[model samples]
Target: MTPVPEPLPRRVTVHLVTGGPAGPRLFGARVLFGQDPADVARRLGGLSEEAPLIALDVITEIASTPGRVPTPLHVDRVVFATPEAVDAWPAVLPPHGMEPMLAELVAEEPAPAVDRPRLRRMASYGIVTDPTGRIMLSLIADGFPGAGTWHLPGGGVDPGEDVRSALRREVWEETGQQGVVGRLITVSSHHRVPLTGHEVYAVWVFSHVHVAHPGPARVLEENGSTADCAWFTPDQLGGVRLSATTRRGLEHLVGPA
Candidate 1:
């Protein structure tokens, strides 16, 4: 029998890049263990902008920069976006992006208690509801986390995939339903040791998706994490065994389920 291969460990680095007439400059970078990097950056810089967090796919942008500060750290990806882009999600920020205190924001963040290999992932989920106000949910397939429990229809965002596009694809694959993506509801994170025995950190972005006309729901993906799908009235949800995140999202979007 062939042994199952473990997933490669993952890490995230949040870099404070400044923008202005002087051009984009690498301000500082920090390795985040389990906390959400965007939220940390927001609190540290006191940014009031409501733009999306952008992911940096290239490493040379940080590794081969001039005047870069050295830290005892390693990372897998970087998030580079300015908070001052007014009407557009520009590739960089404006002159007034970060506060002057950003240089001192390079302190290392706390890691998870377990010292196993770390994997950080961002996923997009939807609180899918039809015009009739019934919520749609999917059942977890056997062998995955929360097996047999009902869960929100979504999964990890693929590499180079757009967040909203990923959510729409996941909704259709897991529930065979289409929804118009709406305002972002909330961002939630959870850390755990999974069956693979890896230290997994999941950052979930939840949004409100509305379906105009509905149809019978079913799982469309082959051998996917979702085993089944169905629509539930608000009263009926109380008896369903919902995944922790699903329950949390439900309580946040609507009333307690």
Candidate 2:
């Protein structure tokens, strides 16, 4: 069977008109075309033939107010793009004179909902802290059969298990460190492995606790889900290779400074 092609990224643009007695007028427009130069030329040719040419005089008249001689009106260049690209266009064009005003007009649209059906699974992770509020992390055993990235100690909440209870149990089972799970920090949604399957709902808790003692952290069972754990400072957090969802969860707890 032939492999399917991935969707192409879209390009978009906005046009702005300034001058005349009244002030300025802004127009939002878009053109859908592929990235190839030939494709772009073809689309441009089609547009030139289909759309009537915009007259400078008409643009000036529209910009001018009653009894006021219209100042030299400037019609900015035309731009093109798909709907998504158009929505994300920058407020201002070139010439650097109209950036502030034009940028205000550029707006971001919300992402469309995911279409795939996924099982709703909840997992809780505790940002467990020591006496000085340093975060705890762990490394999985070499024999463990899972993604071998260093991660916070936690696990999936079984059926009938409360989120906090699950966190405590998982932490103790994985790291042998006992601590109380505290307030809820944030919840994030992420697609499961292979990106073509179900989604995982992860809840992160900012728990306040003191570590009783430091012990060797290891993966007792050879589970194929998690492999290692270790403590990470905020600076070290960035260097650790974590799943996208896990990174998002941690970022939620430690917001932009």
Model 1 earns a TM-score of 0.64
Report, for all candidates in order, the number of backbone clashes: 0, 15
RMSD of each: 8.1, 19.8
lDDT of 1 at 218: 81
What is the lDDT, from 0 to 100, of the residue 50 in candidate 2?
A: 42
lDDT of each: 0.66, 0.45
Q: Model 1, 1-257: lDDT tens per residue?
A: 99995433233445445456766544334435566656655544456556454433223111211247542222223344463422233345446542222333334456647566777776788899999999999999999989999999988876545557888999999988988988666665777766666787877767788989787798899988999999998889889899987987898766776
Candidate whose TM-score is highest: 1
The TM-score measured for candidate 2 stands at 0.44
Per-model TM-score on C-alpha atoms: 0.64, 0.44
Candidate 2 residue-wise lDDT, 1-257, digit = tens? 99995422212222333223453333433312212221232354343324322211110011221234422211222333332223333442335433223233233323337665434334567677766556776554455423555566666655445556777877777766778665445433333444776543322333333465655655454553455556666776767666544555567567631
Query: Model 1 clash tally?
Result: 0
The lowest-lDDT stretch of 10 consecutive residues in candidate 1 is 57-66
